[model samples]
Target: MSQQKPPLQNRVDPWGVLHAVQARGTLMGNRGILHDDQNRIVRHWAGKAWLSCVLNPPFEQKRSPFSQGTYSELFFLDEATAFAAGHRPCRSCQRGRYDAFKAGWAAAHAASNPSADAPTWLPIAAIDAVLHAERIGPDRRKRTHPSALAGLPDGTFYAAEGEAWLVWRGQSLRWTFDGYQRADAPPAGDEVAVLTPPSIVTLLRSGFRPSVHPTANLYN
Candidate 1:
């Protein structure tokens, strides 16, 4: 009898790139039920809101990862990937980080808005709504905004030459599951399509540095 091939892994990078890897992730995120009846992830997401969460809760009962569930357990390369994927830190398991993220997000927007009545803090729901629209289009492909590569903050991803490249410490690194490959820097003034949302980009510029993969260090 022919042995059945192993099921495909369901890990996702910040840019919504899927990977079938043996290495485990440190955090978990969700994009609703992207899987079908057979528990296989389809090319499209079933819902709009994506969320970033801790691996496990201290008080709640633990379940196996990727167990049959209402939501798909998407993995990230790091917190940077999670944020870029349009997920905010979980309010329950990651309260401290969540608060910081909220504050930074609010501050970033407030700076850009420059309105006297802008609130100092915005609810998570509002942030999620904006992220939902920015992360994906009506057809579920990754949406991008036009911005200069130099203007985008560290931890942002941009599309160039038909591939996603990560910006880190003033350099562009080609994204790969194994590690990032150093690539030629795009023109500082040229407009490029930014993968990370505008608000999150502001947060990064406002000093909310997300964790990056070790491979990023090689370029620095």
Candidate 2:
């Protein structure tokens, strides 16, 4: 039997030669902060953070910082780096982008893929259709504003956790939460209501204090 030799140790700095003499907080342009754990430059833009994969990061064509454009706060970089930095999609300029990305991501995820039925990409419109089918309504029957819940186009509204989602098709509504966190199941024969970002923000701006964490703040 052959004996394996011990692995050789690298004498060079892990982050790179350029950063050898620099301190930890030294900003290297697009490199962001050099993290020891991942050995990559990590940075947070918008609401998410990410780590750069390569040294010379590519510049994304974005709105000028001084100019007033729709996508001013947008950041463009490798997907791997974006995920590492811990950032989610922007609800405004990146709304469509996030919706598409999330749909494709959910479809490819193993949790979405059940036995016998392969995972499929559902459109945002489909989600609306499915929820409409549920026909949810308030229990009190005294006319009131609907709860804040909206679905993507894929015929399903993904809950906070990926485990379950809401499916609405006209008056037939169903809340699927088999393997995830969920509220009480929708009541039978009730008309369900969905809320969009703009409406939610309008309520918040009007002094509506929400008990839960605010979602869709960027959408408005």
Candidate 3:
């Protein structure tokens, strides 16, 4: 018999669930420590500050071994997928992207503040608090809001007929553990359950373009 591979516990989906999959993605992420010494996932998360990072970040290199940190190392197929999972860019490793994300987030939220002079910059705690409310509800379940499919910006993930789909460049792409596959275009008037949090969706609307798997370009 062929030797079976040990199951890994760090593959994260858009809803923040972890799975054992062979497909390793371009981006790495985490939400505190959820794994035990055996590398088994013991909890959904330990904190609300979920973050997406570059693979094998140098900053992480100085802290501890990859799998020895307080958080279990997680992987995402692309930045878009990571964002949909309620993760923001890691400041230590992805400084440039984090700056852009911070700027975009401030701008997005400021637009709706109904104040004449809203702050253009916000603290990390403030940002995380807003994202935490939108991502996890009091019931510890993924929170979703309704939005018309056509009105959503690119990189906004939504659910329909029990499948996850990414809205990109006027297209809907199905999300798999491996890559994005094309899905049938839904009606312009169809309202769907948006998986990406409202705050992140607003940030996307403010033009914070996420890096998607190259497969997303296949349909174009």
* Cα-based lDDT for every prediction: 0.75, 0.27, 0.84
What TM-score fits each model?
A: 0.85, 0.21, 0.91
Q: Give the TM-score of candidate 1.
A: 0.85
Reference-based lDDT, residue 192, model 1:
90
Model 1, 90-192: lDDT tens per residue?
Answer: 7777899989889888888898889989889877778888888988887777778899776678888887767778888878888765567897755546689
Indicate whether candidate 1 or candidate 3 has the larger lDDT.
Answer: 3
Per-residue lDDT of 1-220 in model 2, one digit per residue for the tens?
Answer: 9986432121111111122221221111122222334232232112112112221224444423213222122222222112212222333335554565445444444243356564465454443333222322243111113343432222222222222233322222222111112245455233333322222223223332322111212112
Stretches of candidate 3 exceeding 4 Å from the true structure: 1-4, 61-69, 185-189
Winning candidate number (TM-score): 3
For residues 1-220, could you state the per-residue lDDT of candidate 3 as single tens digits? 9998765878878877788988888999978888777777888877778899998897556553236557778899898888888999999899999998998888888886749788888899888888889988889998888898767999999987777899989889999889999868555356888989999998888888899999999999
Local distance difference test, candidate 1: 0.75
Give each model's clash number. 0, 39, 0
Candidate order by lDDT, highest to lowest? 3, 1, 2
User: TM-score of the candidate numbered 2?
Assistant: 0.21
